[model samples]
Target: MATIAPIEYFDEADFDPFVIDDDVFGEIEDPYAIFDRARANGPVQPGTILELLGAPADSIVAGIPQFRVIGHAEVQAVMRNAALFSNDVLKMNLGVTFGDTISAMNPPKHTQVRGLFQSTFMPKQVAKWSETLVDPVVNDLIGRFIGDGRAELVEQFAKRYPFEIIYRQLGLPQRDVQTFHRLAVTLTFNSDYIRYGKEASRKLGVYFQNLLEERRRNPADDLVSLLGQLGGDNGLSDETIVSFFRGLINAAGDTTYRATGCMLMALLENPEQLEAVRQDRSLVPLVLEETLRWNGPIIFTQRMVMQDTELGGVRMPAGAIVNVSMAAANNDPAVHENPRKFDLFRGTKSHFGFGLGPHMCLGQHLARLEMSRALNAILDRLPGLRFDPDMPKPTVKGGLMRTPRDIHVLFDPS
Candidate 1:
């Protein structure tokens, strides 16, 4: 990794790291409406979702023969048949920004990379972290404004806890939390901000390289130490380790941050549902599943067609870019009754929110554990939590990512 000046400070005035910039890809107030129309046309369409929506195509996938897969079955088919549809599309785009991590690789390599830490992220293991990590971090964040009676949940709590949990798990310095947060966001949308993404990747790579070395000498009980201790024939190179670290920060932060905000916004908009969950804590999982289906953090995922194939009666040629619309599949009326409604009582749990098949989200268990703890903490500490009617109503919007940027609410101080 190229050396850069020590990243000691981040200016707070230039931009708010917690908020997603609409300009990154071009914001759409109702991307789902566009997806619905596209799906209505045909489950598998010739053009990309951007073109179908009349928006500009991302430069990365521009000029390529792109197809939009919208039906639940079609999207599932593409995601499940990794042999026919490869994830190498990410290699050309996210690979440059996130490094050559597991997210960009195919079987064998992807399997091995994911296996190194799969045991750590398993559901059984993640549940154990709630008491040791989630509860304290969540309670401390809530305590910051428990007496204020009103607060901006996004800026104050939702944005902070997810990164804090992941940073602590890696034994990262608490002081550099803001720096890492900024870098993670930049790397995520690197295509939008090319120069900054390159710089952020280099900075984070250097930071991780230094930490890896320290862990090598001191051997602490942390994720970084585990990565550092690997040796013999199966050992990983520093470049791969740094790449995995960069991917970890990128994966561990954004989805949870946006999903938490989305969940709160969903509940705040529907007071009856919020009250129901508060009364029946068992319904908390339903709230999360419904939120993910109604407005998942990731709007879509991309795959490369490996061989000529027909899906939903649409013929796709080899090397075509397939934009699998998860948001569309989740809200498909065929699979979900009254799909648009944010019903916490909805029974069907089938959706591609965390994706499916070989490359399913490895951090899903941890993400769920974090969101569950945060939601429960808010309900317990903030009595009568509801949208601040005097403030602007929060709306979830984005071209690819979906979440309310801010959710102002009022609660009883007592």
Candidate 2:
């Protein structure tokens, strides 16, 4: 047998964190203030928030046009009305990079493609994975750093956990995890990272193509095999299957890592809440939900106007881009009491963190399982977990996909 060539890894050192301007997305310290001002204007705010970051009105960032929506009701309306507000903005801008992904598809096609993998992520399967996969991954990762007394959770734990789960679930070789991580970050984080994103996309395409062929010849009990078996009857073309895998890999890997990091940061910043959840393990899910509301991994998603429509009393032309700010909606005072506060006791409420409507996140159940397990494991293994006072406190950043840049912390060694 010919030896398979090892995947070339992207050097993390090559990318300078300082080179990316914090202001690229505007004051990361408090974007809620900006969201508040936009909400005040009306439900449907015109112009992209990137303008606040000094981008020109017409410029495209990561293939997204300049438009903004902050109202909770209005954002929900846009998300619900997929027919009027098409989700193919990425396809329109990025060409065929995503193929006919569920995120970029509409109606009958989206329904058909989404149904194929729906069972895989159902609550029952998610629960099985939680016990069999998520718990073990979380525990092992924490075990690696537990004895060190101090660790940067982002690099050491949060980033690696979800990537490993998704890679294994997809039946990809473990050797490619680092490459996938770098590619996922570049694709999801910033528009300035577009060039790298395209390169990553290209590499992933080749990688998936080979994987797809292997799965076709020799099926297995994994996502790639399931997709390969879908065939002609399910309305999934070979190209669509490849794109779906690409989209899944990107979504599954990127969002969970950031969401977990954000949740930890929320707890760390509010030590009282951290202790409350630590003491009462059942509160972990509530804290996770609240973190989604307060600081979701995806700040906003773009929708293109399919026809002339009036939203939030503002007239919009066909083809106009509308930015649906999930972060803003999560903080809407109308729906949430004291929306700005991070209260785990806030109880059940709707949130767009995993998105809403037809294109709602497919991996949300899996994400919730992974986060719940990871957070619970951290608290169990590392008692008295607190931010390292000697090190710089981590701050949430990015206007598009917000998360703590780093999470430096110390825990009781004993």
In TM-score terms, candidate 2 sits at 0.92
What candidate 1 gets wrong by more than 4 Å, as runs, is 1-20
Best prediction by lDDT: 1
- Return the clash pairs for model 2, or none: none
lDDT of each: 0.82, 0.77
Per-residue lDDT of candidate 1, residues 1-414 (tens digit): 122234543333465444447767456778877777766688888888777666656887777899989999999999998889998999887888778777888987777877875777899988988999889899999998999999999989988899889888887765678878888877767455666667778888878888888777777778888767653366567878788888878777778888999999989889998998888889888888888888988878899999999999989899999999999999888888888889988765888889999899888899889999999999888999998989998999777777787899999995
Per-residue lDDT of 325-412 in model 2, one digit per residue for the tens? 8888998888998888888898846899889999898988988888998998998899989999999998888766667778999998
- Cα TM-score per model: 0.95, 0.92
Ten contiguous residues with the weakest lDDT in model 1:
1-10
Best by TM-score: 1
C-alpha RMSD values across all candidates = 2.5, 2.8
Cα distance off (Å), candidate 1, residue 73: 0.2
